[model samples]
Target: MTGTVLVTYGTTNGSTARIAETIEDVLRKAGLTTEVLAARAVASVEPYDAVVVGGGLYAGRWQKDARRFVRRHSRALAERPVWFFSSGPLDASASERDIPPVPAVRRAMTRLGVREHITFGGCLEDGARGRMAGMILRSGKGGDFRDFAAIEAWAAHVADELGRA
Candidate 1:
């Protein structure tokens, strides 16, 4: 609780990374030590007292890097307080209602005894990768749907929980 927190995320077009950075900012502002990193860049979770893992959802699954990160750090993560978040759904659905984790993420959470998981609205802008992204953009569905207020509130909650720990 008084130790460092790792806020790592996997993102393709950088939307999820922004979300993770926002989380890190709130955690740091709460007087907690926090580091934000790309999930593929984190080498270990052992140095942190808690971890927050996030990813951009694609096809009902977390991005490959996030999935691999969880798989690689399962043991260490299971020993520490861990939270998961997903950033996808290029609509206001996430803000309008509680969007549950994708099936794979739910299973991972159960297996790791993860404390909580949240799904935030995603972002898709002009330069997003993948042909599907272009298609979605062409179809007029691509836009920034992330809710910063909700994100900050969630981060504050995490900080509160950690303070209690």
Candidate 2:
């Protein structure tokens, strides 16, 4: 079925927005109609056939808006194909391996029946606009650890699933 795909995201310093846009681009290239929107801009889920929600992680949690989006629309979301992704943990160092979603967020996803959930390395820059936040992020560790290939692959999978449904 040909239908609208909503790519909604929350980002602290725009990395997650970039990821959301890239997913939208991948879906568009695969002949799907897509709309990329900030989570706060989404007043309702009425227009979408499927949804992909993404956000950056901070202090071991998904962005607040993202969690609120799913929590507020859980029932409507349960009726559609939905995917969740988190951007955090800058690299694949031993310390960053297998970092899972936070407990409350994981429980919410389970309650909402989210089709898929992924955690990928996020980026932290030295002199970016959110310089203070970036500095704090770097005080412990820092890197641009996103894997575009994996992101694209996941987008492809979402497209395939949408095509099937």
Q: What is the lDDT of residue 65 in candidate 1?
A: 95
Candidate 2 deviant stretches above 4 angstroms = 93-99, 128-140
Candidate 1, 1-165: lDDT as tens digits: 789999999999999999999999999999999999999999999999999999999988999999999999999999999999999999999999999999999999999999999999999999889998899999999999999999999999999999999
lDDT of 1: 0.96
> Residues 1-165, candidate 2, lDDT per residue (tens digit)?
588999999887788998899999999999999999999889999889899999788777788888788878889898888898888777774134655677776887788788887777788776545665677666867768888888898899988988888
TM-score of each: 0.99, 0.89
Candidate 2: the clashing residue pairs are none
Cα deviation of 165 in candidate 2 (Å)?
1.1
Which candidate leads in lDDT? 1
State each candidate's clash count. 0, 0
